[model samples]
Target: MSVNALISNYFTTGALSDLPSDHFIDGVFVPSERGNRMESFDPGTATVFGDFAAGTAADVDHAVSSASAGFALWRDTPPARRCAILMEAARLMRAEADWLAVVESLDSGKTLTEAYGDIHGSARLFEYYAGAADKLDGRSVNLGNDNAAFTLREPVGVTAHIVPWNYPTSTLVRGIAPALAGGCSAVVKPAETTPYTALMIAELLIRAGVPAGVVNVVTGTGQEAGAPLVQDPRVRHVTFTGSVATGVGVMQAVAPNVTGLTLELGGKSPLVAFADADAEAVAEGALWAIFSNAGQICSAGSRLVIHRDLHAPVLELLVKKAKALTLGHGLRNTDMGAVNSERHLAAITAHVEHARSRGVEILCGGQATSDPETGKGWFFEPTILDGLSAQDPAIQQEIFGPVLGVQVFEDEEEALALANGTEFALAAGVYTKDIATALRMARRIDAGQVTVNDYWAGGIELPFGGNRKSGFGREKGLEGIDAYTRAKAITLAV
Candidate 1:
């Protein structure tokens, strides 16, 4: 069916039909023990579309217990059998990519195209981990003739995954795929606003031969559901992706148990352009860096630091392109889409307004808007603010919106300083033809991942994470699987 037809059939009068409203636990949908429900809004229209279980401490405990039991069974299951199950899950994900993309767009207010890519990435994550499942081989150490030594990789037991709202399916799968591949069963707590896709993914895993209780989903507010899951001692490992404040909270909650943790917090990453760089390529790269997904990405290149000689032309190009971006419903496949919710729209507005009050130049848009046709969505204009100092709040803080801050630098040293000014060291981008300059910046930049010519150059195979206040540990690629595993060294006399 066409995309419009599917939307019309499922979403009528601001209410969705056949939505997954209950938590998926023990391979079945179950109501929360508290019997509470929270309404989820359609950010495109700013109206209620569905409600999901308001998970509480009791619900979290139940899910964790189920995961613990499943871990016992799954960890003992042969690696080959586990590999087959994960491969089948990836196949199911591919078969339902279209439907899953639609659901993701509805829940997260991202463009249909971006949502489609997210679904594809999600499937690829499962596929990648599946390929690595049976290959987690231990290495033997060469010792004296009468002595023998080897190492073993083992699952860290039941794990808790606290998924953020933005990039719901992608982030959820990014963490859990490796956990499952490493033989750990998981209890997931999806952001309340975007829980539908998490539940749906769990259901798909169950259908793909993941045994009962191997994957569970609980949806609710962070304070109630997330804290409990993180604090649960039965959960031996925790994977969380969100704000630095919350990531800190996760660390505190896990402190008593000393549980293993992996955190991918947010970033105010930079896109540095040199005077010798191709202006056209830099403009295009800058556009995709900051505005893709309406600039809600943790790795979004929100700060543009360019040489003084090239700033004006690049700024003009960026303003022209940013002004022309179309915004509306995600299903409409516009150039941009709504910011996740009304609250988020307000936050973006506040940041822009604060910058403007400080006499910063508002090069283009600086106001909140709505869907031009329906006039109801929580939308914000693509914004560009200039004349900001290195310590400006707009430059240092993670606005988590489509607002780009521009700064000019005179030379390579100044550019490097500005790019690495913020507490976030998640990701950065460098655009220059000079190989030596690119190599120097790549080595000196504090970010975990630095792309030389492109803002987001790598794929699912690359390792991704952050440093300093942006949180620690890595996700994606082989390093991702390592987070879910514990290493044990063995020695013996033969």
Candidate 2:
């Protein structure tokens, strides 16, 4: 079926009348400097559906120059005016939410429900930051004597945003919203796997009164476009969401320039269920945490650390639930969707194979699927594994698929040790009826974000990020704006 036909039947709404063509940079849909093109594949069909201009290093340089120039004007624009424009952008985004959701689902191979939720979250992020635009103020410091001291919060100039493909729509906006709110121009490198939504957003921002060059998007490989954007002297801040290795590369590229950074990397997050926890509820939480988006999520709770007494019941429930999920095309309103791409599917399969070699028990699903109804899409069954040690590859490394590894803990101490064992400290989940124990575990876990009694207990209002190898800096919430701004001290003699 054609992309349009698929969306028209599945979306049952006018989300996207048609997909946009070309990249948006410097207020125009211009061809790439390299004049190269690449095909975007639909993971559901394992077939190319759209072609996009492949960005180059030259494009990145031009984008940086444009953003630097645009920042000069935007930095001086009144906060109220910036806020107004951001609010308008939010309105426009909500107005086309259905279309945007469809495009996002098509590009990223996520379920339509998940894609729409991400679109809504993106709009809410803009709205939240729009309110913060005018309220971003520095503090006044007291220095004794006849001297008066105060500080002013200012934009950090041009920012480089390297967004991942899994949650492309949300991640792009998550970075852009705050940077724009702080009056910083942005050079965004959208994941080549998913660039359509970003392109349309750039156009909408311009229509909402964002000046030319304020938001430039380059779509291509990280080496050609992303690296230059990070290394460019003009980019004052860099925010990236991807694997740990890529995040490290971004850090190295931006180190010489002393550019500010917000890195949201991968995680092998643990979901702990205590003896007192509800087995069904914890099972449900684990399913949503890891199986959602086919477990491509960075903060997916793929590692389950359960109390010895509760492990069997929770494991039983998890196995049953895993086997029951209806998997097919993302647009089909199925319980689960295909893995993002074939390469990703292969890596996931390898992990399971390695686990088997290590004598790990396959509690439930473990292999990739060839669903007749789903055709050639890269689909993996929601899998659960048992008898894996803490150091096992499947337990330690990030599979980034619908695979969950189980670990039994005799007590709170053991659970804490197991939960905090890995270098990753991204997000963790705790399920227990005892409020005191939940709070205690939340504090002990090394993860940046911890959920009590549920997998995702917080919303956009709360700050989220990771520590250690999971990467530093926060996204979402009031603290997020700080990533894009700097403080300047001002003093007056009285």
Q: Judging by TM-score against the true structure, name the best candidate.
A: 1
Angstrom error at residue 229, model 2: 1.1
User: Looking at candidate 2, what is the lDDT of residue 474?
Assistant: 98
lDDT of 1 by residue, 316-376 (tens): 8888999999999987889999899888899999999999889999988899999998888
Tell me the lDDT of model 1 at 144.
Answer: 59
lDDT of 1 at 351: 94
- Badly placed stretches (over 4 Å) of model 1 are 10-12
Between which residue pairs do clashes occur in model 1? none
Q: Give candidate 2 regions above 4 Å deviation.
A: 1-6, 9-18
Tens digits of per-residue lDDT, candidate 2, 137-208, equal: 889898977898999999989999999999998999989999999999999988988889999999999999
Whole-model Cα lDDT of every candidate shown, in order:
0.91, 0.88
Worst 10 residues of 2 by lDDT: 9-18
lDDT of 2: 0.88
Model 1 scores worst on lDDT over the 10 consecutive residues at: 9-18
